[model samples]
Target: MGSNRTNFRVIGLFLLLISMLLFAGGCNNKNNVLSAKQLTDNTPLTVKVLDVGQGDAILIRGGGQVILIDTGDVPDRDKLVSFLKSEKITTIDKLIITHPHADHLGGFAALVGQFAIKQIIDSGQITTTALFRQYLTAAQKKQIAFTVASEGDQFDLGSGILLRVLAPGKPLLTGTDSDLNNNSIVLRLTFGKFSMLFAGDAEQVEETQILKKYSREMKSTVLKVGHHGSRTSSSLPFLAAVAPEAAVISVGLNNDYHHPHPSILKRYEKQKTTVFRTDLHGTVTIAINGENYTIMREKGENAK
Candidate 1:
């Protein structure tokens, strides 16, 4: 854990250099541009898409930071905390809440009592949910730094691991059917040649907005499928733009919403992109070493 904090300042400085380099070409946001002296290449990066039952709970470890994208639903909060303990994760450096939805932000309060949370980043979409208030209070009590995800804003998650925010910028959308869903935090995390795009329940509206703003920068190695594979997301154009070699869908078995729609599966197949579903595959894990990467599942064999 100490080594993880060692590169925080160096990475921050490197990120500033990257920002300045990208300033002239604002949209050319390269996910991985760390110099050899900066990256801890010997320490492989791993991303775990935990099986949280109908919700998103992604754990990204390596480069000295333990980052959690979204917690599972409230009912599964204990499972989440127990899993972290089992992994020996005593602290979470970054806990990013994609939106204010119950499923996405549910386990926040639980982790507050269980772990040392260093900082929190959320969509900042105001909602009158008790769970939301609970997380706010927890952050306040703990005095953890809180940030609202913004388009083009990037954070260095220690040791040259870059978390680039791609959507939910200023002038938030309004009068939408699900303003929350459309304004969810969309993040592109990068380490060396590996990159995973975490689209937090972002629907077609948000997808379209990202495509328009970051078409060239959207290509990634893996994509965390948006809206639990709802028909409202993964628009063909958007898919074409990102062109992730593999896609992971976090959905529960026999879920009420019937997520990871059959049509979306067909689209993934059409694009020759292998799809992994938490309901069918259990926990899906991706390990990255330099330019090589492998995806494994808890219930099934390893995927290419």
Candidate 2:
């Protein structure tokens, strides 16, 4: 009877160990891509076009990740910080500087100190401004990972969302009127049936290159208008190739540059693409769930 009892105890111990092992294996599968049925109303991707006034700043949140693209001009320093705090964004997974222009990169110094930024993706373009130098120094001091994004790099944002680099391709442009603006890092983000193209202030030269090589790939559900809708960018052919259903322009209101040029607005109208401007519309938020999306503007109505 004593031997039989001991045998039963050993079998119980073995079964307990098996149960523990199975539990651990399930926990380890966290990184697996979400299946279709799993993409219910639980997790939705949110993209916010912050009203930085005369610059670009886009916040993308989904899959438990936060991505920031560009930091508006220097004057937006405090406002940007406040916005982040309001959103409860403590850490930034990725910070992408489309270019070194002041309007696009001015808030970098403040951001480095404000949040725990893990990685920085640059457009591989150089500028000799004081702010640019300070920005680089801060990143170096923090020892954050930095990547000079090339044309074909892809970033997995988990949960079936992907960000693919589409510009700053081989043999970078030269002899252009503004080399810096032309080489801005362009990105295309895809989540299920929805896609958005970020055209970081890219002008005609850059737009021409993209349409020439990847016109077919330019199609997107949303397009962040290039160069704040300046006449210098957003060529008709380029816009036609993109054929976006919606366009968002990040620009200031009645300040120095009269952006979202009238001609450009006409072009978008011709394309039958609804337009949203951060200057007029305090902040534009686009929430996406699978193939459907909802747009909420904090300020003005859709551009007329």
| Best TM-score among the predictions, by candidate number | 2
Which parts of model 1 have CA positions greater than 4 angstroms off? 1-43, 301-304
Off by over 4 Å in 2: 1-43
Residue by residue across 179-272, what tens digits does model 2's lDDT show?
A: 9999999999999888899999999999999888788888988899999999999898998888888899999999688898999999999888
Q: After best superposition, candidate 2 residue 287: deviation in angstroms? A: 0.6
Error of 1 at 151 (Å): 0.7
lDDT of candidates 1 onward, in order: 0.87, 0.88
Residue range 1-304, candidate 1, lDDT tens digits: 7877878978999999988887756434232323334444354688999999989999998778899999989998998998899889999999999998999999888899889999899898888989988888889999999988799899887676888999996888777779999999999989887888999999999998899899999999899999999999999999998898889999998999988789998999999888988988998877776565767778964232
Assess every candidate by TM-score. Answer: 0.84, 0.86
Candidate 2 TM-score, true structure as reference: 0.86
